[model samples]
Target: MNSLVLFLLTVVAFGSCLKLPSSFKKCDRKTTDFNQCLSEAIYGALRILDKPLPSHGLPSLYGVEFPDVFTMGNSTYGLLQKFYQTRYIGLSKPENINAKLDFGPLTITLTIEATYSQLTVETEFEAQGTIVLLPVNVITPVVYTLVNPTYTFTFVLEEYEKGTTYFRVIDSKIDAQTQGLKFDYKGLFSNKVLNEEFNNAMDEKWRQIWILFKSFDEVLFAPLFGTIFNDFLKKVPAAELVDG
Candidate 1:
């Protein structure tokens, strides 16, 4: 009788562990769709930055797709964390700091800020770093220099206009090297064209980051947290079990 009772109890416990296949089917589908939308939006933004703009007019022509998704993903995550802390948690006071963006041959670092009022964007060349020289005892040392340049271009947008809007940069300060290096070593270097292209590229990056923030807020955060909160309330047990 004792063995039969134990067998019955084990079978009941096993049956209780089974879950209906349809229980989470809709949630799974929704999660997949959300991921796809986020991926495409991110891809489109990156496509805008991949190539350098051709030298022609005030706003040079170029696609903004390149730079692996991993780097951009990090930037997006950092921005989201900042948003949650500043807007939701009401923690530390917001302030400006130098943020760095690196492309293969070029790096644009900016001093930006997040506040209750608006978002400020700015960019400058990276300057403060060590330069490695080849052959320490060579007759003539070939130096591989790392230059960090400073730039200040501030574009402020009202907090309300952040997600569904765009801003134009009317004025900007350009570094001499960037302005002079428009084309290859032999080609004609136009300072005007170089500055215009550079500024346009920076603007595109700013917009891309903004788009990422919107996607995270609307799709990922909204669905995941909402479901988790609801489920948590439903599943919490009213009483604790004591050890027999």
Candidate 2:
């Protein structure tokens, strides 16, 4: 709803589009090939999401559906109309990716953008949307476009099994930037002037929301990959893949 939430969700929702990588060689060799391979593995994995994934019978890519109105953490926004056609779009491979070892941790950093994404809630009268924070229980279409988003995270393998791998996101940071934002509302409490005033007010105050977005959403989003990556690594450990 605000810049923080916009930035945080921007980073998170789109990440769901990625698929786990297939295989790797041996992990014993710590060489340039290892870093390059790991980087390419992540890139290839995310590139797979350029195609849609099935949801029941519908196609979804990083798709997310909220009830007509719902609350997540401290944010809430929804439309008066709910439809099955809503889907998430524009999740692509990050422009750059780097993966390496930091002593005992596996570190990865990715540069990404949501320039082509369309996140909006549609209704009969007005299809409103916002990348900024919205009021609780408000009736409005929602859209947020993040032009650039980057996340750097370090993972430590706390536990590893012969057939399973376990890791945790010990340290993480996000560098988020936006090209522009849009928030349009038309409903019960709207005088055209009042709506414009409110929207402008929110845009002016968005910076206050960044701190919360980073603290909360970072925790929510980063671990998602750890669980899945842990599984992937269990199947393809660096020791086994790094040509040792």
The candidate scoring highest on lDDT is 2
RMSD of 1: 23.5
For every model shown, what is its TM-score relative to the native structure? Answer: 0.17, 0.51
* Candidate 1 structure quality by residue, lDDT tens digits, 12-45: 6444332212211111223435434433432332
Q: Write the per-residue lDDT of candidate 2 for residues 1-244, one digit (tens) a residue.
A: 5988877775654443232234312232356576666666655555664554332112223443322322233223433332233333343446666666434344433322223333332322232333354433444544433335444555554444332232333444443444343444444245678777766765565556445435533554445445534444444433333343
Error at 39, model 2, angstroms: 2.4
Alpha-carbon error at 229 in model 2, in Å? Answer: 2.7
Candidate 2 global CA lDDT score: 0.43
Q: Which stretch of 10 consecutive residues in model 1 shows the poorest summed lDDT?
A: 137-146
Backbone clash count for every predicted candidate, in the order shown: 13, 18
Q: Identify the candidate with maximal TM-score.
A: 2
